[model samples]
Target: MAISYDNTGRGIKVLVNGVHMKTIPVLLLEAFKNHHGKIAFDKKRRITPEERKLLHSYLVYLKWIRKLRKTEKHLYQLIKDTYPVATRKVITLDSERFELVLDNNLKIKCPEKIYLLFTEKPVIIHSNY
Candidate 1:
């Protein structure tokens, strides 16, 4: 499966065998599944030290934002300004969710359509240039 984020940041374009499959919302999603499955993504690109440092900082920033939302309203406002987060996007699967390999040694839960597209055959995931 090839996943590409829309250039306008509207949604995620999912492709199967070079054909359009579905477009999902742009979300920070986490996938959970109990069943073992095949993964086609490359796992050889280890995160560099600098990238690890940046990732750590990003996690800390998210933690701070969560804390600020509860404890410091003014500070949160100053931080987020007018950028209100959109409503959460949820995916419900009848069977166990599938494991989706992502960059930076990450894995996410995706619906069956997306999962089958990726696991049924090898695919080259592309980025929007």
Candidate 2:
């Protein structure tokens, strides 16, 4: 998957497997809240470090999903319904770790090791094992 800025430089174009997907705004400020837990854009609409990290993680996850959709059809079908809901929920990636805060107030921790496998290196298992 590849992400590029739109010609206007105000939105992002997400491409999967060389196919163009929909373009969304570069910054989804409404999907996030401020440090004080406020969801208003009173201050400047700047992308914080936490937001940047969360966005990067989301992109990596999307790429992984695209790969899984092709190689693991069953698994992809099982989780497809949850993907949209999960993406719409609030996410926070701070010094401690990555966390997904759901609408029902349920908190889920994102595994860094799994993300590393998709973004950095793949884990290889020998047939002998």
Tell me the tens digit of each residue's lDDT in model 1 across 10-90: 644444456554443343211101100121223323333443333343344455557778988865665542221111122
Candidate 2 ranges beyond 4 A from true positions = 1-7, 10-42, 83-129
- For model 1 the TM-score comes to 0.31
Q: Give the runs in model 1 whose Cα sits over 4 Å from its true position.
A: 1-44, 81-129
lDDT of 1 at 103: 33
lDDT of 2 by residue, 27-103 (tens): 54223212123222233344455545555555555666678799889766755434222311222343344333334
The best candidate in terms of lDDT: 2
> What is the overall TM-score of model 2 with all chains considered together?
0.39
* Per-prediction tally of clashes: 1, 0
